[model samples]
Target chain A: MADAPETFEEFRKSFSYGERSDLDFKFMKSLSDDEAAQFLAGLLAHVGDAYDHARLTDIIDYVIDWQARAYAPAPDAKRTWVYEEGPFATPAKPLADSRVALLTSSGHFVHDDDPEPFGVVGMTQQEAEERISEFLKVPPELSRVPVSFAPGELRVRHGGYDVTSAALDHNVAFPLDHLHDLQADGVIGELHDEAFSFMGAAAQMRLQKETAPEWAKMLRDAEVDVVLLVPV
Target chain B: MCHVSVGHVGRAIEEAGIATTAVYVRAFGHVVDEMKLPRVLITNHPMGRPLGPVGDRQRQRAVVASALSLIDSATEPTVVDDLGPFRPVGG
Candidate 1:
């Protein structure tokens, strides 16, 4: 009935919780940083010892997603592009006889070459952890990994989803470990020495035009029979 | 474009005359279906955690097993195998 409150403090007095009107935002603009930090910290503790911020962020994302799914169903996305009919290729050998390669669009990379504009490889372990912690908390800045990537060099840089769990165990996205498992059990014959992580979501048209061909050549050069592409 | 790139990359490798199978979620699976690559496997997993849920070893292994199998079983370009949704641990 009265004119709208002009100042934020005046507006707060006019607001009520759980109002189903235009001003019904559940989160408050004036929320304190300590409050938010503590809240997220508690959530992080639930997923890990609280030291591993990456895993905590990932678990929190999945948990929040789980809760949201229980509340409402997401609508199907519309397709914008109609692809032309493309090539069809099949495996030439049996599972036990074929060599496999791993490819993922999860924005993961080996941190060796250059942590880049945000590089942290040469930093102390604690310093690297601190930098990576900042990386996960902030918006993602992805890098192109160079040759000579090893298992311990794994880093998750995807902005589309939580990198926490993937940070703790890089295999969740890349699954190079599982590839080895398959080879050990003879489910697959062997793994190529190289695998790749794409900093996807953005730079996509570039991927289609240039990067995809390079990836194809890489896989082809590996003598890979089945290229297992795991898209995030 | 994040999702459709999967099909693009798959198409690229397929063009190389090598077998390629895409593992992805529903909406993107629709794109993969529309694009119609060499082999496709649909799974109901989260966006970033495509192989399976985070910290889930056995589930990841299950997903990998089924996805790789599609490489062998897909007789045509249109074949799409769905692995359904992620079942939370102990659910």
Candidate 2:
């Protein structure tokens, strides 16, 4: 285990620019404040529309039962936080000059993107449960689509969290429009032709192992310089 | 961006040689720091609504601006630009 750093500055220097075997399952309540000179905890000012206690109250109990089993890891193994000898990349140019790609892990897909039973709304309860079980059982995979894909065709199928805001406007999570605005205003130079979405949270261990590299390949394929990640 | 947990993916992309940034729930700010994610702009809007609230163009645009700007400015591990304290407007 790595010794903890007392301050942000110390924390930055202590970690030998590498990864270590440490668990990341800290709880989510009571984040700190941005009130004075110091940085705040999770920095959440207010919960958005679709979120409430009903959804989050069971997180500790549920994720242990849900995503923990999704990848079929050995007991006592840390499934989510994969360590790496990271060489963190930096932006080469100003935002207005970089080709940007956006990825959202909000379980979003256009209606036509679903092949068969995956998005069939009227399936029998047994069928739905079985399909969800299968979906969760497999390793993580990403759904890629053209940024030009119609927003009206977008729909969210994730059961992990409230999708109300995303259901209202995909921009809440997959802000392709906002990105376009950025492009228009010269905040970012170019928007990649494609955008990607993963089905759920990054806690789905399979994502870190398989799907991420695939997404990285796509970003590389597009000559993307800056990528933006937004969560739901 | 969508799930607060996706910061790891941002770090992966950064590792892949593309600089990255994210906007997520403020509650996970410390987690983002510990994971040493690239440029992140965190907001206090509810969990799923990381880009401000639903249908609020100004807030969403502002949030996106802050996130993108991290590319131009951030030079350290897991340094954050907190957009918390800003209220999302709608349901």
Candidate 3:
């Protein structure tokens, strides 16, 4: 077994904020002075050994779960379009039909696009959905959100039994369904027929590029107008 | 879709000349002074998931499109707009 964390603070530090700090900074910028203070207060309140591993995990998980629901898309806000240069560009003319495709990979099934390639892991759609649901349960509001699986080209090998079972399960790290739902509600106006997904983390970009053409083709076949890529 | 820090990815995308909008959930009705982007949306939702609940296809599309539309409609360098709530069905 590994050495126990030196202290509660040490264990907390092990939670690994790394790039997540960047995410937090962005989140802070979006807040008002008072709101920011409240957020910081919440974070401060949970510090120290007041909670154990399971409890801390639950707290962190609850924070993430709360944030997802709190950040769920609003309907009245105006939407904007972003078109990447090179291959993916918004056409000069709007698409006649606004069909969009949703794409995502089973969590833990890391692909080339993932920044941290933990490798592949076998998981059924049902298992992935259940895992995602459990993840959302910490924050009750998110329980209402649904999960959908759209066929796509990205694939990876199962990490196998030696790997921790948790490692093989889909983490659903991002709020993908929320993004897709926004698209379908006419809030996004138009969506490409096919959406794309891969394992979460930093290393998956390579796989994403290689697989992009195939996804593009899928969108083309579906006569999709705008491809909305969601990070899950 | 992809929840990124505004300062980190938002500016990078905008600096690249690609139109970009940052959506702030939970900070709704709150004014942000440091935002330098072309368009931004503020709502009362949480972070990580800018668009509401996962798997709600209809709601996701609407949020994405609304963010995209700001690019064409925004008149100022930094426009701050509010999306009241995530009422996907009737509202």
Q: Specify the highest-TM-score model's number.
A: 2
Model number 2 iRMSD: 6.6
Compared with the true structure, what per-residue lDDT tens digits does model 3 show for residues A81-175? Answer: 22332111333333223443343321322233332322224444333322432322221110111234332323332111111212222222223
Count backbone clashes in candidate 2: 15
Give the CAPRI rating of model 2. acceptable
Where does model 2 exceed 4 Å of error?
A1-86, A115-136, A201-203, B1-5, B86-91
Which candidate number has the best DockQ? 1
For residues A203-225, could you state the per-residue lDDT of candidate 1 as single tens digits?
55566677678778877887888
Q: How much of the true A–B contact set does each candidate keep?
A: 0.65, 0.58, 0.04
lDDT tens string, model 2, A1-232?
9977565433322222213211112111111222111212212312221165433323323322222222233446553444443447877888889999988877677677752345566343234323444655554457676888876887765534556678888888888998888898888999998887765533356666676776777787779999888766
Q: Candidate 1, which CAPRI tier? A: acceptable
Runs in model 3 with CA error above 4 Å?
A1-5, A17-88, A103-195, A202-209, B1-48, B53-65, B68-91
lDDT of 3 by residue, B1-91 (tens): 2232222233333333334444555432222223343455554433334455434445454555565556456545544544444432322
- Ten residues in a row with the worst lDDT in model 3 chain A? A137-146
TM accuracy, model 1:
0.65
Candidate 3 docks with a DockQ of 0.13
